[model samples]
Target: MEELDVNVSSSEAFGIAEKIVLLSFISAVILMAILGNLLVMVAVCRDRQLRKIKTNYFIVSLAFADLLVSVLVMPFGAMELVQDNWIYGEMFCLVRTSLDVLLTTASILHLCCISLDRYYAICCQPLVYRNKMTPLRIALMLGGCWIIPTFISFLPIMQGWNSIGIIDLIQQRQFNKASNSTYCIFMVNKPYAITCSVVAFYIPFLLMVLAYHRIYVTARAHARQIRLLQRAGNPAEPRQGHQEPRQDHQEPRQGHQEPRQGHQEPRQHPPDQHSTHRMKTETKAAKTLCIIMGCFCLCWAPFFVTNIVDPFINYTVPGKLWTAFLWLGYINSGLNPFLYAFLNKAFRRAFLIILCCGDERYRRPSILGQTVPCSTTTINGSTHVLSFFFCQRRGGGPAAPGLAGQRNQRGCAKVPGGVGEGNALFPQSPG
Candidate 1:
């Protein structure tokens, strides 16, 4: 008997320790999601350079959705886990579950919006993008992101649309005295589950994939064009008079090259350096956005896939496994902050300033001629500067009527080729 009693005590102690560790882990995740996303919002709002960036509006909205998930959804999910049952009333349970769906859907949709914004900026008409994506239009888009999810999630959940007609097994289980009435579970309505999954995950995912693919292809084509231009331009011969610009955008075939037969040479065409610079920007942005999208897929896909499958299987998925998937979705909110810090230079600079209270790099020069040494590296052959409005304007390009209005803007300059103009084929940096 004493031996049995000792084993029982040890088991209880182990269970308690395990619970503590679980609680601590969840708490850490929630804390990270809150702090990291909050920092993003603060940095964008506070920094002069970041504030001027129009695309960051979508980023701020995304961070807000993630922050809401951390505050409204994760803590309640943690509560249910720790207590081993939902202690809150059914009304609050419905509210909490609705928030879970709404915030995460908002996060995914905001990503879609960001992808679209980039697509227009990098691939569409610059004037159209600037005109259409103004502050009011962006506000409306953000409003729709939240409103659509609210209608799909909270209202339907309250109206019992997520619940199927009475199930004999679930009904019987509910009446049993030993069954936990406080535990919350979806009622496995096939139509509702499928519809929600399609709207929330599948459609937006396809759009993002298409946008990024086009962005990638466009960047590649620009790089190839620049290389051909560089190889074809010859400086050895001088022309007698200025040559007319070629109208054909197509390049000469490698095997079909011909030498100048006359005693004159091709006119010395100035370097379209801004075209190369814009291509690099487009490529970098595409890469960074792709990484973010990849992370989103890895984090949320499992949970959503399982959620859809559970209904088809009559919700036979084990409670532990279901909860695990839910937590996996929540993990995304925490991961985004770290991803931003790593991939985005501006975010890293902002985070360092926020966390360390100040950055020496941003500090002013001391008196008496003392100055802080700042080292810079040229990445990918360009002198890298942090431009919030990247690859949207250029200097040295042929001045166009379309770019005349933009010329007054800071960092707008004429570059070789029609760089600052509204040409879809070439974009220019704001540097």
Candidate 2:
């Protein structure tokens, strides 16, 4: 196949306007990705409720990937958009391209892992999610995603066998003879580039799509089973001969003590009529991750294929065209957090907490139960309160009075945590 001979020329006015637009877009994407993902990281870290769930561990990895992509790739594309060439040194060029490859791979794998998490959560009838999604497994999956792809990206640079390698050997030989030439990051052959594409992009993409499709089918099936169980009769309720335990349990200090603070710990409540709604929320989270992964696949697929596979194919995609695809592929970095804000409640609240308070998390008592020491009040037209719980978690139905200190509990700290009947969830204020 003949190489694309694009002249790559435009009028000064068009170029300047294009640069301004691209620069603005890049800036906004960076701003949102950093702020949004940092919020997520903080929420997952500081909130015990969020950490208890396995799915959030995947969210943490996904946010990290988005943040990494913004820092590693977006700015370079912004600079190249203005200068119309790779002005940075050859080493940076390799690093930029490699980071793009590795982080994108990590992002896709994270989404795939999320799909798996949701699948079992909804599908397995007898097993509880906590029993299914153990801490060690989540940690192992995250570790595998990052550690595995790193070598796939970095080895090319270390061995001097990649694009930089090809250019460097040629440029140096020419320099030994004469000093009038240039050094760039262009690769030499079809096999080398194509191999990188297969390792970094195509295989992971195939896995993500298949994994999500399976997750969707499994979740829907589980939801249908749950609906059936409710319609037939509450499978969870015991026979007429038995009685359910009281909320405070077998306590000697019931008169002087507070009620339990969260969803009854030993699977006390099965999702009921609102099961559909819960399913919908879960589905939306899956969809958001799927969209994010799909966007990443589409954006980078063409560029990688054209860069690597095009050399062997009959159609030679222009360098500029491929570069544009590369930039588009990376656009996902900035788009992820905003997408979460729009689609996921937890993420939106998390974003608000970080942006408004300049911190990742604030601890308070639970909001849903009476035992919580803190009470709600309106301050400056915002619903806020100081909570008593030392650590706040985000998900597991409405918090009992013991754990509602989420993003909504931003500034009003005077409210107490734990029940007045007992000691506050946290120790009394120092002051």
Candidate 3:
């Protein structure tokens, strides 16, 4: 393909009103991405419920990556937008561009890791997920998420492999030499562009879509099995029958007090019924996360698609149109925190308290033991107390006897025995 010459021109000076609107828009996006993601980090760190769930590690990591993009990448992009020229010299330009690639790619990679986590959580055996996704393992994955993108961005751009070959290298060198160059853009040839598109966007996008589809399929199959079990008659009654003895045996083996064992361990949920209930919960969560991944794809697809095509088209795309798509990509960072707030009850309440500087609704427990101001949200008419990554039932289905006495300030009631009488099902909190 012949190199298409683009006539670059300085943007016309904006009127005061236009300038104000542009600055306000940029500021809003920057603030939302920064503050929203920051709150997510805070919630994960501070909230006992969120901290207990291992899956939330992925959420925290994702939020951190988005925070970096908001702080490091978006501000520089904003500066370029306002100035209409690369006032910052070459070293800073390289740094900004590298950080942009590093953080955005890290964000996408974190989403991929989350999808993998959800896939295993939903599709595999509970024990399998428990054994596989340890904290050390997750930390390793997070490390790679940052490391791989940094290598790709810095090595190629700095070493000039992204431009490739003699002619393209000469073009990049001459463009750098031009002290009057107005725009900050990374020039790349077909190989580097195509390779990066595959690694950063296309491959991750496909994997995420496929993972979500599999999760949906598995969830539907589980739902169907539950329906069949329900039709076959009350599977729960006998399952509950068996459940009592198991808890009875486990409690005594673990040295629960004799009096407490009888009071706590005997209470049982219909095992099949609770299993079905849990399946529904997992399915609902999978759907919500899939929707988030879909939104991310929608926001970023245009830019990555154009990113690859631009090189092949000899960079023919208009600068303004390219800028629009780039900003559209940035919109995903701003959208993620809001998505968490909208979908999850805990996040919404946390956001409200954090943003409002404390609301009266979140009152501390009184001496006589008042309501701890649990973060409850109305979902399909029923109230959901979103404590962690899982949808905790308001009353965790027939509370054990010891629970009433053991209720904590955050509304986490400790039930005796290994049985999770009033707790989230997977990875029951230690007594």
TM-score: which candidate is best? 1
TM-score of each: 0.70, 0.62, 0.69
For model 1, where is the 10-residue window of minimal lDDT? 372-381
Q: Which digits, one per residue and each the tens of the lDDT, describe model 1 over residues 20-116?
A: 9879999999998999899989887776555665656777888999999999999987876676555677678778878888999998888788777
Please write out the lDDT profile of model 3 over residues 217-312, one tens digit for every residue: 765555554454343333245566767767666865547455654554333223334445645665665566566777887889999889889777
**lDDT over C-alpha atoms for residue 238 of model 1:** 39
Looking at model 3, which ten-residue stretch has the lowest summed lDDT? 415-424
Which one is best on lDDT? 3
How many steric overlaps are in each model, in order?
A: 11, 26, 0
Note the Cα lDDT for every prediction shown: 0.62, 0.53, 0.63
Residue-level error in angstroms, candidate 3, position 320 = 1.4
Ranking by TM-score: 1, 3, 2
Span of 10 residues, lowest total lDDT, candidate 2: 418-427
Error of 1 at 321 (Å): 2.5
